[model samples]
Target: PVVAAAPGPKEPKKGQKLSGKIAQIGDNGVFVSFGGRAEAVLDVAEIRGEDGNPTKAVGDDITATVVSVGETVKLTLKGKKTGDIAGLLDAQKSGTPVEGKVTGVNKGGLVVRTLGVRAFCPFSQIDRRYIDNPQEYVGKTLTFVVTTADDKGRNVVLSRRSLLEEEAKGQAEELRQKLEIGQEMSGIVARIRPFGAFVDLGGVDGMVHVSEISHARVNDPNSVLKVGQEVKVRVVKVEDLGGSSERISLSMKQLESDPWETAVDKLTVGEQLEGKVVRVVDFGAFVEISPGVDGLVHVSALAPGRVEHPSEVVSPGDAVTAWVTQLDADKRRISLSLVDPSERSERTPRFDRGDRPPRRRGESNRPPKVHRSGDPSDGLTSMGEAFQRLREQMGE
Candidate 1:
């Protein structure tokens, strides 16, 4: 009878080590099935990878330490010395910056899912460039630095801009070496500011100044160009003012046509043309006869009658016939006259009159009038005296 000792019933206890298969994975946590029954709940923070993603996934058979064995056994990878989730988190916390995909975006920031962990990246931390629409970042992968983590390890904050700024700092040096003045390169318009547009030239960004957008004057970069427009630009200047950053000046107009050349050809003195009124100032109206070809009609020359302001005579978009009275080829200045008789048929006066004197040899006809002062009975004076007295009387 010594052969059969009663086998003791297995004792279930709390804080015991166990192994299970991951039954399900969700946004909040993962579920695992232990030997005896109900599944165990593991928070997302407790089930992370070395890179910060979940270490155990659905259908994964893994060992976990049981922290509580009641109606349900609560297992924590963090509690296990052998299967320490903290080790994974610690490794993630210590490792180099990781790459993340922008999964969602909101008013405050972007929701980035990286290494199985969800992180919040504030708008300021999203990119180095100004982000007018942050929603564009969704589904894009970016490198990010872990700026903060919650005590319960629930909320992790990330910063892609910090990583980008660091990377740009290094790349800027390299770009400075390769970038030379007058070098032509392709770029995308990254941002449009009041003063200029920032162009993304490969790794570095250069500025396409407002004046450089066109050979003609540019009032605003936003008017002529927009964000994300691809354009070719020339490097106009590279100034190492010796600050924290170097300034790179770029120009799109330089790569394009010289407006002055076309303007000089298209707009010459005595060139009669029709134009649309572009602008009206107190001094004159600016008419664009062609692309980049503009002429200014002074207020005095706007009409046969006096005009206080050019706007009084013509509004914007009005088509008008004008004569190019003067042209400065080098300065690209064209003086126009709206009142030139050739421009308006209705404004010209007729030469035919019934009372004009008869034509003489080599003499043109002149208008005739009744001679009241020269009548002898009315004057009663010498002809010269009468003419002088009449001239004085008429205040001639």
Candidate 2:
């Protein structure tokens, strides 16, 4: 009698997932049952727990992926695995990312435990930006790419910033496709400067100038924005600066109704309003009538008479009353005349009654010399001749 032919060793297909019980744990790798005589062998380094140690026993429930099928099925934990010295070295050469937990911090940098070995991550390597509080990273597990490593993995160095940079580079094209003028997006404030705040819009950076930060005056960007704060901004402009560089202008002010729109409706000619002087120039002073609305008080209208400069009559932060003489909403211009309290009840802001101003200091208190229609002394006297009278009195 002929016996039925026996089947060859059952081979698992490449990338096929397998679920089985641990058959054996050896110094080289793990052995898991794969139904028939064909067994699954996986490197011990593939399944390291979060504490940087291999904590598996025989017969333990485990899952693995079939990476290759030779005489025996070679298995893996899929994706990128980092749990041994060999793994870190491979990552260093291949530029693959590894996993690490920030255990503590030191003077030089952070102390990270990865793949059962301690690694150093310098403060500068933690992020693309400066890190103020290094301790905040403790107890956080992060992915890192190996920058340097020795054969024993005792001198391993890692950087998260490099990985972030690579990711940003990879996403740049996608970001360009998404950005559009007038489109609103949410982002985190990455940094603050004197002129503006830089917001990280995923993989790109957008600038919100201080003038665009608010409708009210913003003298300091720090007062209105902070690092890592989430904010919504509208894309006002997108310009290609050059190859590999672009500019994005964002605005927070444009999201709200302009304050000038309302201020213009209520401000009519001869309307009296009280405001604080916000700026002073040689020609005029700017008085803020509302939060973001202001009017110009010309030097001629700053005082009851002629004003040499606006600073002489009105200074910054000075509270004053003024009447609007001209308001142009389309031009965003308002002309104001200061209301001198001394003559407010009798006349308007302009006090040009054609009266001679008071004499300046160290000047003659006497009026000008009056003469007949044909007299020689017609408001004109030579300095030497005029002082001759004083000379005769003093005998000089």
Candidate 3:
């Protein structure tokens, strides 16, 4: 039988990347076949993952960089050699991510060991958020993207934040596609502010405004929400600001059943309910009869006789019995009266339809004029005094 010589492998340029299947595993390295004449060897150290186990097995497809081109093609995954510096440049151009070990931290940033060289990662590029204690990242292994590979790999700048942001954007896009307005979803409270709380809906974030936190009035978001608390919320709005920017509005109250849906069952017209006055406005007082529900006691309904102002009858936090006079479910309004509706029905009308009531002494249709710096007899002094007198007369 005549023996024939096998053709030799074609030479690949230094730093050239190749994708192929693993042909064989050896003690020294793993052999890869590109379905061409060549079978490249991947260094055993470079093939291992962080757990110190080979990431690929024989017959598995692998992508590796060419470190040397010769009779035997040398391939390296981590590119951790002086000869692999060219691979770093190729990685920079292709936006390939590489693994690195944090060697130290400095005033400028972190010192990362990657591609057999020390690279600088700016403090801002270390993480998605500002690192208050940079020392925490010291001696930790991490993955990074090569942002700048200038001076032939002498000055390499790496950014872990870029990789993280890219991943977050991908996850956010997926969530956005699945999200729908009025859809109920779960999220974690990432942060709380006076105005609202930011919730982490998977990888994306949405804001729950203070007004939307609960059915009852919320003076502070912190009082209702705490960081890292899991909560169910409804998607009230989703605005795409273009290029991966999004504004999401969430409401916790919407996830729960609306109080008005059952308000009719619990309330009846002309029936009295004891409630606490939550707020007092110039026109009326708002009373909370039940949680997540309020009724308005208008100035005219405050007493049997013609009332000058609502504050004279009730103040904020005052406990009073208010008779529900009207319930408009479509309008989500409940008109209330401090004086019983029966009592108002029995009382005489203050004036006829066309006639105006007689004005009393010192009483005028127009607001009282309080001149600043006026004498005490005129009941006005400084601007503060005038404001006080005006507020008093207005029952504020």
Predictions: Cα RMSD each: 10.1, 15.0, 20.2
Per-residue alpha-carbon lDDT of candidate 1 for residues 51-149, written as tens digits (9 for 90 to 100): 345776789887777777667667777443232224335645785587778877766888877665667789888777667788788888888777776
How do the predictions measure up, each by TM-score? 0.60, 0.60, 0.48
Residue 323's C-alpha lDDT in candidate 1?
A: 88
> Using TM-score as the measure, which candidate wins?
2
Output the lDDT of residue 166, model 3: 84
Poorest stretch of ten by lDDT in candidate 3: 44-53
Model 3, 1-396: lDDT tens per residue?
988987776567889888899998876678999865668888665565433346678888888888888788888774455435777788899999988888777679888878776678999898765566777887898999888886445578899988888888788778877889988998888778899999888778899999999988888887777776799999998888234567999999887778889986788898978999999988999999988899998888888776787888888889998898999988899999898766778887666656977778978789877576657786547787667889999995
Model 3: CA > 4 A from native: 1-167, 341-346, 352-396
What TM-score number comes out for model 3? 0.48
Candidate 1 segments whose C-alpha is farther than 4 A from its true place = 1-88, 91-95, 132-137, 150-152, 188-190, 200-205, 228-230, 244-246, 263-274, 279-282, 315-321, 325-331, 343-396
Tell me which residue pairs clash in candidate 1: 49-53, 53-115, 53-116
Ten-residue stretch with the least lDDT total in model 2: 45-54
